[model samples]
Target: MADATHSTGMIRVWDPLVRIGHWVLVVAFATAYLTEGEPEWLHVWAGYAIAATVALRLLWGVIGPQRARFSDFVTGPGRAVAYLRDLIAGRAERHVGHSPAGGAMTVALLVTLGVTAFAGMGTLAAEEGEGPLAGIVAQIPETDGPRAYTGDHDEDEHGEHGEESAWKEVHEVAANLTLILILLHLGGVALASARHGENLARSMVTGDKRA
Candidate 1:
């Protein structure tokens, strides 16, 4: 099935769920990245959304339609390298779904975003003592009894046990790496677009590409 296009034929490649999830992750990651350390609530919720998206994507990769499944586009590292070489040499094949290198980049981005979300959650629990793990992370000591589940404990009280700084650093590094991955992904899209004479980025929205 071809989508109407002036210059080239198009095919249904990306499914609606895949398209929606991809854009949602893009927005959620961008929101979290831009609002990091400013609005705690926004950051937390964004991270949560990212985590949720990753989960859905993982599930989709397992049981989704042909092009959306991991078995469909994922290739060996050798294949990915060959694809990159072809891309650089201007001989890359135009794929209806993701190309070999693009598939690898998708996996990398998903994993990195998942790690970023996890680290962000840990950081929130350790630093502010408030998150899904709040009750277990930064318990406050009572005057004459066992520690309370309140997250308002003094930072100094938990000390290294909280590992607040460490978790925060991990979160920051993961976020930065995710951003770098995003930049690389965009660059690859531009290069592929020019090489194949197709708007690869827009393909995600319409779920079709030159066929």
Candidate 2:
């Protein structure tokens, strides 16, 4: 018996940078969460790692392999909507790379994670922390503008504005939300893989697949 989709020539799938960036982002995010606002040095390192991962992904998105570019998968919102409609009809198309919804999810995750990271870093550096960026933005009057975040003022030399409630609250909320996103991402990947006959986790790890 011959398989319907069998093909001897499996093509190269993932680029080196894409694979590295994906895993690096995962590890960096985990490290950041584990060390959030506690051990100053570890937390700062985690932030740096995540920032690096984001920067690397941005660069790779510009010059990476064929299937790794933003243009390759980040289709229009209308297309994404259409794809969702297909999913509802149980007729969603499976892509060798990221499907429409998955691609959009990737972009959303990157953006929201970036925002959460930026807010987290901003809050940490502004208040009672000694991050590398702490001294640079030491002059922004956070109270001058309406922000969801609030800073601390402990009169402590750790960058605390003076031990009031401010950025700390913001950081906590954002971190928790980021964790939720990560969980959702995992579940989505699992569901997609199970339904579509793909091993996405292995694809990211080995940079290849049974294509």
Q: Which predicted model would earn the best TM-score?
A: 1
TM-score each candidate.
0.83, 0.77
Q: Find the number of clashing residue pairs for candidate 1.
A: 0
Off by over 4 Å in 1: 1-8, 135-164
How well is each residue in 1-211 modelled by candidate 2, as lDDT tens digits?
Answer: 1212336544456777888888887887788788654676676677677777777787787787768788788988888788767765667787777778778888876876676667667666665444555665465665433233232323558755554435556666767777887786787778777767778898888766665
lDDT tens digits, residue span 1-211, model 1: 2333435466778889999999989999989999865676787898999999999999999998888899988999999999999999999887877899999999999999999998787667665566775565555342122232233444556473433255667888989999999999999999999998889888889888766
**Residue range with the least summed lDDT across 10 consecutive positions in model 1:** 142-151
Which residue pairs in model 1 clash with each other? Answer: none
